[model samples]
Target: MSQQDRIPCFLLAAGRGERMRPLTDDLPKPLLKIQNKSLLEWHLGALRKAGIQDVVINHAWLGEKIEHALGNGSQFGLHIQYSPEGTALETAGGIAKALPLLKPEDYFMVINGDVFSPNLPINNILAKVAIFRAASNKPLAHLLMVPNPVQHPEGDFFLEDSQISALNLGAGEKLTFSGIGLYHKDLFKDLAIGVPAKLAPLLIAAMEQNKVSGEKYVGPWHDVGTPQRLQELNAAYE
Candidate 1:
């Protein structure tokens, strides 16, 4: 991608992490480590490798720690910006808050700060961006789905013919959202700036209009939500 077309990325890190308790009480979840590397750093390394230079990280609880840890992102080979929501806005709201900082691109990548997916493919994401850029009818959102882990066996959405649809009365093999996605800015444009909002409703609304698409990603992905899950991931990844 040319410098003129280099798409920016938004890192979703503003969650209060209620599930991850005391560990998050002192540190924002995104700053937590897996195999000695902070989650945000792992993501930064991959994003930089993917040739995405600009990243906006939104944080609420102990937000300053994230800024202190990563600084201006010079060490990560990228320019960084922070969206410090004083109180954690839910997913969509956080992205909406950072939209301006994401540059003027119509599309930007969004990744969940807490998920551990070190092997997410960079080239695949770039290819999808290319496809979206050239499509006559670009999807409002495209997600990378994963086979449901034991903890979330029922899963989130069903993937059929490269389109993502909500479970139809609980039928079909459901896949877990990898929490990594490419989204058209229009998807979140209507969300109120400061109100807390979840992303599911927005994506579901888009899916109802055949505006969302996705692919299954079979990779090492973990949603490190609980202390046990975190411990298991540390031992397993170690």
Candidate 2:
């Protein structure tokens, strides 16, 4: 598929960032700066480079600041839209709420706005989406898995030969979810709009049926959940 035909993407920015404390006390976590640019800006630049045009950002806390900073996304060569929530809905809830804006495509990409991944393998994931849709056993989601960070040592899921499962399946390597995924619209069909729901339950349910897929990404990736990590990221870039 051509770049223009690539799927739309959603940047999940609605979280309250309670972990970031005083920093998030004023600005939304996605708006936090790394290498002098906002976290969301980095993702937007990467998305544009990956040939994605339409973008949706969901925000709750200090959402106006996000709108003010990015505006219509013209500067970054993207057409941006916002899905504002009265309160921060969990992952699946936010995606469900933004479905209308993302309905143009059968599958859409979602990335946690707070995470910092310089090379997210967007094209590779898109290629996987095409393969998934063609298979008889259509998967509801394709996730990007990374090495578990110190903060999350147990990790989240296991991958064996491209098939992801909640179980270890004996010896497959376990990895932490990178907070980035390509999801089919049908995945959220049963979810009620504006309802608070965590994404893990949905993913785990699909995993039990062998309906979720994943790939390991061994490149630079960071969750950036704390002030120290933020400073560390900035220093690394410098």
Q: Give TM per candidate.
A: 0.95, 0.97
Each model's lDDT comes to: 0.88, 0.91
Model 1 residue 172 CA deviation in Å: 4.9
- Give me the runs in candidate 2 sitting further than 4 Å from their true place: 1-4
Please give, for residues 27-72, the per-residue lDDT of candidate 1 as tens digits. 8898888899999999999999888889999989888899999999
Q: Residue 88 deviation, candidate 2, in Å?
A: 1.2
List the pairs of residues colliding in candidate 1: none
- For all candidates, the clash counts are 0, 0
Best by TM-score: 2
In candidate 2, where is summed lDDT lowest over 10 consecutive residues?
1-10
Q: How close is candidate 2 to the true structure, as a TM-score?
A: 0.97
